[model samples]
Target: MERTLVLCKPDAVQRGLVGQILTRFEQKGLKLVGMKLRQFPKELLEQHYSDHKERPFFPSLVGFMGSGPVVAMALEGIDAIAVVRGLMGKTNAREAAPGTIRGDLGMSFSNNLVHGSDSAESAAKELALFFPGADELVDWTPCTLEWSYSVGEELKG
Candidate 1:
């Protein structure tokens, strides 16, 4: 199965929508392999968001991320990265579609309720950042996945 990292941002935790947000991924048949609630340290946040360091909005982004506790998760499923992004909708709540997580519950661009890995490479980086222990994840097959994959098809790492 493809694995992706998903983050229920500070706002979501403060607003008590973590359960609802996670429910969408579970309902979509994504397996939750690892999860935790964490208060991000500035160093970790800087490392995690280093790519945006040169951007004008980088400070605000880091400030918001470190402001409260966030729920980080590792989800596994077919095309998990893409699937999670689809569920999250666009970054701007106003531009997100009606049925997506952001569209339905998000208040603004900066306060968008969730974050999902944009690619396999990003998934690895983010997952490592959130779950530093190599053995933190429990790998197991989800019973229902037998019906989702075709015979002889192997899941991607």
Candidate 2:
């Protein structure tokens, strides 16, 4: 099993898609280990997206993220990293395929509705950032061969 970080960005909350976004993952049979609705202070946003700081669009990205509340979650399952990203779809909404969270709800790149860890290392770092000092992120031992999975193996975080 792998651990991954899942973020339902501000747009998801603002658009009242929190339940829908979560249902996608839950229905996929992935375990929701830890979660919280956090108004990420500027300080934390800076850390979470520090890698993008040098990009020209970084400021706008940061501002948009801090503008509202987001749901931070810890997901556990096989290939969870890839699973979440596949469900989130492309970073650029225009390219996102239908049926994905981003494809279904997002309209622009900057406002893309969610962010999943892009790599395993990043997932660990993100989990720490959003759920520090917390364990039991997931109890995902399901005794079954078939389970609904939201992502494919290609998008491994």
Candidate 3:
């Protein structure tokens, strides 16, 4: 099973849309394995968006992220990295499609409201960065979630 990291950014938390955002994933058959309500320190946020460190928007991005708590998650499923991004839609909410999370809810580019790992390698790096050492993530069995999984769990009877 492949795993991807998902983050409902500070805006989503402030807007009280974490449950709504999460439901989209759960309904799409992505298995929610690890999740938490947390905030990143300045240094961690800097490291997480290091590639953007050189970008002009990096300071604002860091400030926005540190503004409030965000929901960080680890989801397990087939092709999870891409699947979650597809659900999140374009970074520019204006350019996203109607049914997508960003299109439906977000506004500014800086406040895109969500983040998902962009690739398998990124998934590994991000999951570790967001969710750190053992059991930091909360585990819960979604009742009847056997219907959603990676590998052959899709063929469940």
Cα lDDT listed for each candidate: 0.91, 0.84, 0.87
Output the better candidate (2/3) by TM-score.
Answer: 3
lDDT top scorer: 1
Query: What TM-score does candidate 3 get on C-alpha atoms?
Result: 0.89
RMSD of 3: 2.7
Give the range where candidate 3 is weakest over 10 consecutive residues by summed lDDT: 148-157
lDDT of 1 by residue, 1-157 (tens): 6899999999999999999999999988889999999998988988888999999999999999999999999999878999999999999998999989999998699999898999999999999999989798889877877666663666533
In order of appearance, the predictions have TM-scores of 0.93, 0.87, 0.89
Per-candidate clash tally: 0, 5, 0
The local distance difference test score of model 1 is 0.91
- Backbone clash pairs in model 2 (N, Cα, C under 3 Å; residues 3+ apart or in different chains), count: 5
- Candidate 3 error regions (>4 Å): 137-146, 149-157
Q: Which stretches of candidate 2 lie over 4 Å from their true place?
A: 135-157
Which residue pairs clash within candidate 3?
none
By the lDDT metric, which is better: model 2 or model 3?
Answer: 3
By lDDT, the better pick of 1 and 2 is: 1
What is the lDDT, from 0 to 100, of the residue 40 in candidate 1? 81
| Ranked by TM-score, top first | 1, 3, 2
